[model samples]
Target: MDPIDPVHGTATLLLIAAAAVVVLLFLIIKVKLHAFIALVLISVVTAVAAGIPIADIPTALTTGFGSTLASVALLVGFGVMLGRLLEVTGGAQVLADTLVNRFGEKRAPLALGVAALIFGLPIFFDAGLVVFLPIILTVARRFGGSLLFYALPAAGAFAAMHALVPPHPGPVAAGTLLGGDIGVILLVNLPIALIAWYVGVYRMSKVLGRRFDVGLPSLLFGEENDGTGSSGDTDTKTQAPPTFGLVLGLLMIPLVLIGFNTVLSTLIESGTIAEGNILVDGLILLGNTPVALLITVLAAIALLGTRGGRTLGETQQLLDSSLGPICSIVLITGAGGMFGGVLQISGIGDALTTSLGGLGIPLLLQAFLIATALRVAQGSATVALTTAAGLIASQAADLSNVQIALLVTAIAAGATVLSHVNDSGFWLVSRFFGMDEQTTLKTWTVMETTLGLSAFAVAAALYPLVS
Candidate 1:
């Protein structure tokens, strides 16, 4: 669909965007409306209020909704299936037990977080978190404390990697738009992301975890375990638990495949590998997130699902059950995307960008602020990063490569913060963790802000040195 020009001035668009978000929060938080219905209803109202042509309103709504689902549905489906198999087959238990043994009970959360940082390098946040759900639950259930202790560190680590590092679209797109070397951006930002995660995410999790005693959510894997490593699954109770090595190998499959794709794609972009090679194309297809996850699910069905006297029919049932719990989650997330899409098409982000572009702040600060505004406006971090980078590109022409990379870091930091009602990620964490909207705001939202601020501080301090 073609972009729709704003029929009103910037102020009117901004007001409509703000009013829409307020009404959305009111509907969900106050009126007790189902998030999916509220999001859809508000999306329709917002489209009309923002002056979207009556003929194009449906297209705007479905475009955002469908686009988000296209990325999310398969990942969530395959990921939950993999997680269910791991949970029921005791693969998650094996991994959790090994980590607890090596790291000791006290350091289990840290161990999970460090592992997620590694896995997150090649995986996006939603997929990585979904795949890690069982392990996190297994560990948290064993340790008997707030789930936040175990969940936030791991979740935040993935968020950090996804937002700041390459091979994840946000930073990669920002780096490209700003003419930063991808290799340099990766090398430079990796450590910064780690530091930011440690300071902002890991450290804050301890505080928030202690403060908020969120229990384990039973949404995905059913009832809590009975302390016998069985999550109330009958087949799992009789089957011998999977070996730690086998569990680890199953988890590593996607990581290795996705990493191969990232490396190969980077090489091709750098002209080290020729494009149009049949083998490379095939490998890249295998490495696509959904395809890689699909392959992993199939492998799990063979190795874990049917190995312990469980029939294929039983395995299919297990996978089938996983989808039911996630249907609402999937819909709510898509609707959130729809609302954001309406805002984007209505020119809220464009209005904000135009207004902020001339603000007389320092270039790095301007970059961060613009990205933050766009993120807050439209709820997509990738959109924020790419849009903000393009907006600042001409002004940054005389800067050094290192300076541009630092600017990219700043943009990423801004995009990372302030995820709220409009962001699909906010709902993903809220539903998965079983936290209500307000609770999610207090914990996940706050952690994201601190994480972004920490990253921006690092980038700002380094910007002058590079100059």
Candidate 2:
């Protein structure tokens, strides 16, 4: 539900918007408030201050929150289930081990990063990193160098993919809000994301690794007996890890289905095929992001769970457990959407568009700058990207397909930059890597900036060709 703006003037709405952001930052960062609560509180304040009808505020808040959740909740839920299946059954280890063996020790970081890029496709950053922690530590200990050499590349890969690609909530929410085609986004993002990661994260981490001498921790997350690279499931003692080929197949299924949808839609649009063709109709259902994920999750359970020796009941329990840790993320994401909705309804978006629209800056640049400012201000990439996309939605209406997709990537790149004290990712990486705040700023923060700017540069370069 798009909120009707009660406040008419640009200056008034702009001041109110600015105050909302400052208050939000103060509450979340300085006051140590929970992000979900902080966002909800600030959103309400923004609405009231912007002269939203007091009686209609509830409608605006729910409209934004519900709409965002309609797209996000399903993807996140299915994706997490799939990731949990892989992690519990040791498929992640199979993939990691195969890559490391194939790439050799000298190029360990590259190999880990590649494997992460693959697994990271269906997983959130924090959860993915946790699942891969044992593997990263194992590689670091074997190679005998600073953990950052291996850890940074892998973490950077997850961070890059999560920020820039679809089916992860950030890009998906931004794409949905900006009216970009999800299938097109998936298609164009692959090559761009890969190159950006290699240049920004992979090579950059190698350079930074030489500068920082971070020691590998003998233990992490209080798991004392953490020798095995498995998901700490002692019950999987008797079960053999799934073969690498099998794991790879399960991961590829969703991508194939999604690609099929993209190609079919393109063909239909070009008049090569009719839109109502039975084949097209059927394929569309299978290719939808949520449906593709649902099918993948079922396949993972069947192949990795029941057929791999675990009972259906146990598998059900595992999938159910995956939801618990992610509840906060899901809620926070919804709240972020609500905040963006308030900005939209309060006329702040239109105000910015009107005042700043004539700067002659490219739509992609404006997206990046706005997203970067929001990320720096609020410290949540999902929030920043969605809010930025919402603010810029009016302008994106005239952009070509490729331009819209690239603009989404640009916003994502902006959101990815500068993880710092206010950003939860900063703390996540710092604690997981056993680095102090200062070292985290030097290594993790620097790596993030490199990744973001590099991706944005790639998008900017592609902009002219597409535009």
| C-alpha positional error of residue 75 in candidate 1 after TM-score superposition, expressed in Å | 0.6
Q: For candidate 1, what is the lDDT?
A: 0.91
Residue pair clashes in candidate 1: none
List model 2 lDDT by residue over 98-160, tens digit each: 777899868888888987898677666764565566567667755677889999989999898
Model 1, 276-386: lDDT tens digits are 999999999999899999999999999998877889998888889889999989999999899999999988899998888887989999999999999999999989999
Q: Rate the local accuracy (lDDT) of all candidates.
A: 0.91, 0.76
Best by TM-score: 1
lDDT of 2 at 300: 86
Error of 1 at 290 (Å): 0.7
Q: Give the range of the ten consecutive residues with the poorest summed lDDT in model 2.
A: 218-227
